[model samples]
Target: MQHAIHPAYGPVVFRDKAADFAFLTRSTLGSDRTVEWEDGRTYPVVDVEISSASHPFHTGTARVLDAAGRVERFEWRYGREAA
Candidate 1:
């Protein structure tokens, strides 16, 4: 653990606007935005597009691609040439 060589590690709030979720954790990243946490202290806030709360895979909202339909389209386009 070297002193004065490492970036400042402090509490930061990562906010997911889509999901309207925010969590506090230690980070070396800095932000100009700030938010008052539940502890009554202001912390640096970072906006994020997606998080586990809003991610399709995590929330089981992921759409499955139709491989059969794609195969059918490919066959319709190229199958006649081979025949």
Candidate 2:
């Protein structure tokens, strides 16, 4: 452990605008915005575009890529020549 060499780790809110989700957790991330939490305390707010709440994998909205279609498109653009 060292003194005056570590980042400030405290309660901060991660806000996902797309999903309208927010959660408070300890982090070393810096922010200038503040918000009143459910516990009646103010904490720094960090705006994030994507989080687990809105992420495709976590929310089961992930799109399956069509490999066959891509292969066909590629072949059409460039003649198939086995190297």
Best by TM-score: 2
Q: By lDDT, who's the top model here?
A: 2
lDDT of 2 at 48: 95
Per-model CA lDDT versus the true structure: 0.95, 0.96
Model 2: lDDT equals 0.96
Runs with alpha carbons beyond 4 Å of true place in candidate 1: 1-3, 80-83
Global lDDT of model 1: 0.95
lDDT of 1 by residue, 11-73 (tens): 999999999999999999999989999999999999999999999999999999999999999
Model 2: lowest-lDDT 10 consecutive positions: 30-39
